[model samples]
Target: MEHRQLVHFLAVLDSGSLTAAAQRVGLTQQALSKSLSRLENELGGKLFERGTRGMTATRLGESISEYARDIIASAGKLRHTASAALGLERGRLVVGLSPISAASLLGKRLTQFAQNYPNVRIDVEGGIDRDFVAALHRGELDIALSSQVGGQYDGILLEQVFSEPWGVGGCVNNQALQDAQSISDLADGKWIIGRNTDLLDDIIAETFSNAGLPMPKPGIMTTSVLFSLHALSQSDFLAILPQSLCRDFNGILWRDLSDGAWISPIYMMRRRRAHMDELVSVLLRELKG
Candidate 1:
């Protein structure tokens, strides 16, 4: 229950032995063992099983270890938050971003935000749209910039910031892509596709299905914008990318879908009840601007 006890337990779990944990924590082995014993007494359970190789956590220990880690992390965050609130000039912001949006927009805004809020530490995680949305709901992220995939969340608020047009991109000189106009025209061409649940992939799949074409054979599937671009640049495969992504790539040629517009509506989403701190607000404003 005590912070020191939790720390000792976590050290043992991580180091896999009381001797190593003691050395890491700068305590004698006896002291570390006493601390573990006290913690076990307080919790009424054995935390570890000793073996010739190392210590292993029991089921209850494994469950509590996760909680202990979270508790320690949350406590540190709270201390940092309190310091910032009291004008101590120290804070942290965790922002989640979709990979494509990170490459296209969030990366720049993040740099500017860091320059503006020099005292605030920023951590960024990039993934597909669904993972970003799920992180927002789990309170793991302060804010996120992602393409809208499904309906708005009841507990989260989203503000539309921008709409980016999507286009098919391929090697600039791909001979197989000559005179391609519609989605079906590229059906037989090798395709680099985004993963399922990715906003761009969902849109591309729907467009192809609506055109009564079989889904293009996926030569590569990726969540990384850079990887997707790299694959397109190296091979004769085509990929759907944001207009902004292909604008500066002379090695790539973009062709708009002929049937309908494929636009990804980008949103800045955060939990509805969560307080928007100054740093988060500044980042959001910079993104919107």
Candidate 2:
């Protein structure tokens, strides 16, 4: 019933022999054998059956193995949680970022977070809106910053931090769109679209569709803000960019679509009842500020 005895049992089961298990667990073969024997005695059952081939788990052993794994996993988690609580373990934070947020403010927030919590390791993964949300739901991300697509996450909480209007962006010196007044006016220009979720593309297409104009096929689809900006600045391609992002990019001129305004709400997602670690709370404050 001892933790070490359970570990020794699992090792022997995995290695197929006492000698191999002893070597792996850094114990003498006889010592490991005795430990297993003691464990079986304590549990009032035989754990393993020795045969010509190798050691095999008995029915009782098989039943116990499942519980043993859970016990060991829980013990490890307890140790980690305690260490983190005591500030003995340098924590790790995994953040998921949507493409637009990455372009506007994520980098600055990360820089400031790093300066504040130098001991905590921070990992940033960038993806489109859907992928980021999926990662958050699957527990692969500690937090996610992305646009709010109305949906319920049963055990997750979403906080709306800010809302920004969408705007049409193209080359600064594009003569073809100088007097563009509406979505219908941009019908002849090629559109540059961001891949994933298609939020921007859908809005653009809807604008043209509602205005009785042909929806322009996107000439380029990308997740990279830099690539999208480069394409917009050097060619006649227009992209729907968040107004905040347009403001961040000094040289970009944004024209509001007259069809109606598209407002994208930025949200912070985290597990609902989960404890917010100290570093995470600090980072959230910085983001909200």
Candidate 3:
């Protein structure tokens, strides 16, 4: 019921253990338990089911968690606004990044941001775009970088930062696909598709349609990007992926389909109607550069 109780509950959910949560919130285990007990009594339901591995949120807890995060976010924003007005230069920033964009981005700029804002704590969460957007809406993230389909969520405003042109990537040493240049060129080639997300699949379909070719049925499918990359290296299967992903992998060869039009737009998104914090502006400036 109290702000402290909600904070303790969230800590427990995040830490997944009474001892860890207590340590995180700077409270004794007994005290944390008492707070949780009082909260549950007020709410008339158990929040979490404890286990040896960790504490799992109950159905009611799951529903309440989103509101708790929003409350905490609003409180933090207030603190940040007051601190900025006082020239204290301190606040917390949580960012979300999609799976593909997470690794390629946030290298040099992240370090520079850290160096510039020594007092601002930064936390990053990586996942698919759907998960990232959901977290963004729940106020768990201030900024999110993800490949988005044109105009979906009305709650957030998006700015295009980068364009990831889809390419049919193969291994450098794979002689079987040496002649492949476009989707039609890869007709006879084995395809190793990964996670069948809606956006990705749509891009694949559109790419093939643009090339005036039929979509190649995938010979193998899995969710792991590493596994997909490794499969491409070892086999002749061609994968549809961004060129950014292959920059570090030496043996991988990303062949542009000559279809320049099929590029997935990577967007920097934030909640609408929210004032842009100075810290966020700093990060955004770096990203835009």
Which one is best on TM-score?
A: 3
Task: Return the TM-score for each candidate structure.
Answer: 0.64, 0.60, 0.73
In model 1, the clashing pairs are none
Tell me the alpha-carbon RMSD of every candidate. 7.6, 11.4, 5.9
- Candidate 2 is scored at a TM of 0.60
* Candidate number achieving the greatest lDDT relative to the actual structure: 3
Please report, in order, the local distance difference test score of every candidate based on alpha carbons. 0.73, 0.71, 0.75
Each model's number of backbone clashes? Answer: 0, 0, 0
User: Candidate 2's residue-wise lDDT over 1-289, tens digit each?
Assistant: 6888877887777667777778756799889999999999999999889988789999998988768756655554454365368561377777877766665565577778777777777788865444544444434467788773456566668887656578788878876567787778877888887752345556656777889997667788776778887778777788877766666664567888844547676778876644566657767888887
> Candidate 3 has which clashing residue pairs, if any?
none
Worst ten-residue run, lDDT, model 2? Answer: 130-139
- Measured with C-alpha atoms, the lDDT of residue 289 in candidate 1 is 77
Model 2 scores what on Cα lDDT? 0.71
lDDT of 3 by residue, 1-289 (tens): 6877888888888667899788756799999999999999999999999888889999999999979977866866775576466442677777887766665554446666878878878887766565555556545678888774445676778888876766778899876556665567666778887754466677778777876877887798778888888888887778877777876787898877655755777788887755577777778889777
By lDDT, the candidates rank as 3, 1, 2
Which candidate model has the greater TM-score, 2 or 3?
Answer: 3
Model 2 lDDT at residue 55: 91
Task: Please give, for residues 123-165, the per-residue lDDT of candidate 1 as tens digits.
Answer: 8876545555545544567777777456667677888877777
Off by over 4 Å in 1: 1-42, 46-90, 129-140, 148-155, 176-178, 196-206, 209-212, 222-225, 247-250, 258-260
